[model samples]
Target: MLTNRQLQILQVIVDDFVTSAQPVGSRQISKKDWITFSPATIRNEMADLEELGFLEKTHTSSGRVPSEKGYRFYVDHLLQPQIIQADEANQIQSVFKQQMIEMEQLIRESANILSELTTYTTILLGPDVQQHKVKKFQIVPLTEQSAVAIIVTDNGHVENRLLTLPNGFSPSDIEKMVNILNDRLTGVPLQELHLKLEVEALEILKQHVKTADTVIQSLLNVSTGQKEGKIYYGGKTNMLNQPEFHDLNKIRMLMDLMDKESQLQSLFKPKDKGIQIRIGSENNHMAMENCSVITAPFSVGEEQYGAIAIIGPTRMDYKRVVTLLDMMRNGLSRALTKP
Candidate 1:
């Protein structure tokens, strides 16, 4: 455990490094407003910190910078949660009040606002549908052998799929199948629908004709396949301005990762509560080794919906980022619950 004075010096070093993007020296800390120690004493403490693996020296002459372990320790122990300033809170509330729209639009706008506020790339994943109940389904015939099926969930999410009818199946036959699907599938969660199909409907369809087996398989695939939730990304160019991404190779890898929606979705897998911080090397993606991700999950009613995340270099201001994300989550929750 570090002494109280040593902790103060470490905090000053981190704060200075974050602001200036430069390693902090003992002489600099001694001259700062908060320090009363002499330069030699501070240098001794910095050397001890380096030996303990909390700080690292990038060059022979340069001072110290916080390591990943240091950052994790600071966030978990030393950092205090900052309250959102009055003006910032009012601005966020104003945005939520002015643009009351559908859930999809709201989530997209929230991503835009968060990126603008934090000046870092932001990603918002639309709500997970595992718990969603199918409220309605509509089948529209596009051609004699093809039709469009639109499924609406209880949470205002709409999923559409195009299905090919069996050869020689009439439009009337398609309508009959649609009616049966709606009657049997409405108000049921998606996982249960697959079971119902295999147990009760598959035999009946098979008895109709041997071709019914293929039709049943196609229907089940359309219903239970990937949901393809919407992903909203903003502030792509903002990453270029960060110091850690000055390397072209790092920038290229990061851009590629950003383009992969599946990877971003995996990064923010749901947690219980509060914002989650993933630091360098802890992130599974090689491209994010120098980056940090702060994410918070938001919900609609009782269901955990989706997450909003801020992406920045590992030296990101956690206190400010955490406060901003907390406010964003609250605003999103309230907007979603609004009548």
Candidate 2:
């Protein structure tokens, strides 16, 4: 229930602090062309805002800084839309101009461009590649004792493994096994191949092939070796350049956390669509307490998808980042899904 004047003052403080990475003082607020208030009046309001827990004064300076609460309120209530400049928009569009580019390449370029624009580390979580159905599976025999197993997904991705053929496993046995697998698992997603093979497929294989257990074990080993939609990072080392991340211990902790690929996969799991902002302690990771993350989803058709995430110091320019991300998402969706 802030009065209009108080709200105006709060917005100004947030905007100034974000740009300068410095606290805002009454004199600076009074200097705004639209602000007719005297420095004394502005100072009084700043004090009251501090008392209300929206701002805090530094011990070394009388200037005020926005608390986490203040930043939350500013983004939620006072965010003014920022327009993307024409040149910047053109630059993003140009990344996809080359014909016959891939979704992975598009995501990789997006991460690099976003990181460069924001001067912060960026992460793009590619869609689960394992979700695609198995289009083909083949075993290319190299000799009587060994062969190469290849699994092709509907998306055109391929996985290949080599195994020693079981003793006395015949060429006829190989033909029958391949036939059984293709017939039963052609439409199954790569992630579920193991389970599909184990269920009814195993029994069918036992009845027809003498070395069914050995072959199944070899294929399951291949399935376990598969990795999907690995995390792609842009300017992964840029965090070291930020003033907030200058501490040696803090750098070590963040590096350690980012190295845990399994844990980071869940970071971009958003229940809702559109841009989401998580600031400082809101991220719940101790290493991220001084950072802010902005995330958004991009889709191919109405189905396949992935997420874009930008990480930077909490003082990052929210308006500009949000505008760029929205444009990137729209541009990528249009470009990657075409032919």
Q: On a 0 to 100 scale, what is the lDDT of residue 53 in model 2?
A: 89
Superposed model 1: Cα runs more than 4 Å off:
134-152, 158-228
Model 1 has an lDDT value of 0.79
> How much does candidate 1 score in TM-score?
0.76
Candidate 1 C-alpha lDDT tens digits along 219-273: 6764565564568887877899998899999999999998888888788655666
Among the numbered candidates, top lDDT falls to 2
Each model's number of backbone clashes? 0, 0
Quote model 2's TM-score: 0.79
Tens-place lDDT digits, model 2, residues 79-177: 876998798888888897976555567788889988888788888887777776787889888898888888876654567778679889888988898
lDDT of 1 at 192: 67
Judge candidate 2 against the unseen true structure and give its global Cα lDDT, from 0 to 1.
Answer: 0.83
